[model samples]
Target chain A: MISMHLTYDAQKVYMKVLEECLKASSIEYELNGWSEVKLKGQPALSEIRTFKNKLREAGIYVIENSRHELIQRTKDTISEMILHQEDLKSPKLSTYLTEKLNYSYTYLSKIFSEHTHYSIEHFVILKKIDYAKKLLLESRLSLTQISYKLGYSSVGHLSKQFKKTTGMTPTAFYNIIQKRNRTL
Target chain B: MIRGFLKLAVVEDDKSSKKLFQKAINESTLVAGMIFFQQSNELLEYIDGPQNHVPDIIFLKLDPMVKNFLKDLRQVRKQHQLRNTLIVIYSSGASEQLIEDTFVYGANVYMDKPHTYEKFREVVEKILKINFQYLESNLNIENFIYRT
Candidate 1:
């Protein structure tokens, strides 16, 4: 006999239930996060009713508010772009959001700013600088390599943004880490 | 000179959230030790006690139900021993005003509470990887809140 222990995540279980519900309703959709879903096409009233019933049976409620839905989709799309940097093919973030979300950059930015009180460009810069910091700490990548990987035109550009966001240059950040490690 | 491994502390009242935090911290290679306090007062007491280990990072759950969340944050910032310690605050649904308040009160990072295990793990890992000793005192509002 073999003995083993397994732990189940509640969120994963909810996701599986959601997937089952969506499939049973024949809805074509993409799962962004646990609560956000992007349906491919508008389902008929009856179909929507049935889908909602199924999901409710599993203790899930679809968010019917269009504004909330759009905001969630925009945030998810930006996160996907940042997480999968190599897969990004759009020349600029504005174009990329437009292509992915099927909304003009101006409209999308307007909605994002109205809802979040910050511009989409500012959000993107924050995420990119965060990713850069993570890469600098976790990887052996040099300054130039990190800059290129994050799509900066030059090392100086990356440094300027990093300093602006973090209040210290990359070299200074690394020096602090080194000094801490040496003391350890 | 601090130890090679990171010491972490979390002040959360929700049992499930605490469990998720324990699981995430356990899975990380960077965290050497972690302490959990059910209330901010308990954490403050522990920090005030003699011979207690000072954590390198402190994670506080900013729930409205929890009384004096901001007061506790201010107390933590006032501690000279924790001057360089990174303070991360998280909430499920926080307004812009509340987030701005946390930044003003000296939190280095504000996280939108992750609803999934994968995202929680990723957030914890990313936070652990950063070198925050030099950046804690200089954090700006633009980079204050980290959403995963």
Candidate 2:
């Protein structure tokens, strides 16, 4: 059984993906968790490959191993945090993840990089920039307000990161959007 | 910046209409920032310049005389930056064909511009009250083209 409590929508999406995978493979399986399954008989490599492909086609992540699953959870947690504009002062990301997952940051970082080919810090930066982009075009907040909302140290810090990631200043990006909106 | 404010941009050529529109927007607490353009070209130019501040929502007034303007607007909307912004078409003499065309061209709302300032303010307030992001996440694109 899946241990974590999921909303109705989340459960529906997960169940659909699970049902699809089960249908693709003839072997019976025991559900250990939402993403974990135990096959009754030793399934052939071909059968597993087919099931994986079906899940991918349905836009679901194929968890190869426990490490991969942990990485995915980390990513999901970080994204949700950034999307909600969670305050930075509460706890550092590493500390929060460590406490939430009950794993040391060192172990988490090592596994994350090994599986995802990106550092946890780098992934956080990318997610923050993506969130910033949406906030810029969708909200009336100024750069200063946006910086604080995203938990950047300051407006200057946010600008530097934004420029480094996007190859242009936030103002420039805004201008491009503005120009696009008025073209007609 | 004021919290919970909506940034608005107005693109219209009629002087009286522009004045009324600005007055209505200014009267609303939801409006944090606003910019006006007499011609679509002026708005385009402002956006192209280095000092661009993208608005969250745009109030676009369509003129019947400017056949090329609609075509130009469609072309402008093709850019990536404008993808997230909501485009609301404000028109007085919209034919059924033009309304259909506007929806096809990716407008989110089709509003008949009211003559009275009071009515205009009410319409603007109603539009602002809508949480566009929430509506978008629902993924029902068909209902996006709201008419008034």
Candidate 3:
């Protein structure tokens, strides 16, 4: 669904494309491999291809294909983060991601937003719900158990977010998927 | 120049299909090494990671995730200016829309994951024969172009 994390390779190539896409538009850039701290504005995409070729002429290569790795990495990190938590409600998710990825929240968010067409918060929520859907559909884990597994604070929170994203409550959604499966 | 076994990345989310396909490949006469990854992410990384090691061919197991994956792969191909790699989509999922979309996104071939292992072997044999013929014709074409 829309909630699956952008794979890491896709994220990398995506950010590189975003970086080059911005560079092509004459927007200045900066990076701190450990601490992402600054961003300025939206990119001009009118002459994007021209700049892409120009960058190529300079011998710098951006990822040339799929964003699969990028999304995969992000999900892996999220999964790992949740997997480590003893209490899903009190997860140190933000700290874990920032520390592990070695980028300031601001920079990661900015670059991700520039590349993905979604904000980091929105993306993370999508990922959580996607995982929840997966857990809900694939296994018979109780809602509370799935919530804890997903690092959710409570079943209420999970139900609320699940409803928000899927337009159906978790129980309802699971039932539908179950009925659909039986038919198939 | 170092010559290595041809590398193929097989992307499939399902475990059984992955095993079945790998078994089929192993039993076949193809001179290749197989690296299996369950998700598109690993496949994408193999192509664009720090090594920039694009495989000779990639077989994507078509599913809902594949459509968006192809779209993203297009960006990577464009950014890297890569042409040596061939992407082939295989699925026993049997979705016409998926097959059509894959071709639209530049998949080299879309074939059903054969029902029988022998059928899989036949497909591989045909692919190899075709490539050998293509190589012979390719040399001729280059000679003709140069002469012209």
- Best model number under lDDT: 1
Which pairs clash in the backbone of model 1?
Answer: none
- Per-candidate TM equals 0.44, 0.43, 0.40
The number of the candidate with the highest TM-score is 1
lDDT of 3: 0.55
Worst 10 residues of 1 chain B by lDDT: B133-142
Off by over 4 Å in 3: A1-46, A58-75, A87-89, B1-148
Tens digit per residue, CA lDDT, model 3, B1-148:
1121345677777787777767766653333567888776666666667887666566666675445766654443343423545556676665655554555455545666677878876775444333222222111211110000
lDDT score at residue A117, model 1, on the 0-100 scale: 44
Report the poorest 10 consecutive residues by lDDT, candidate 2 chain A. Answer: A175-184
> Which candidate achieves the best DockQ against the true structure?
1
Per-structure clash totals for the candidates: 0, 2, 24
Residues A1-184 of candidate 3: C-alpha lDDT, one tens digit per residue: 5777654675566467556655656656666562241334533343344665665665545453433344335546765665566554475656776877766767666655444434556656655666677766677888899887777779999898877654457765555445434432
Worst 10 residues of 2 chain B by lDDT: B134-143
Model 1 residue runs over 4 Å out of place are A1-184, B1-3, B131-148
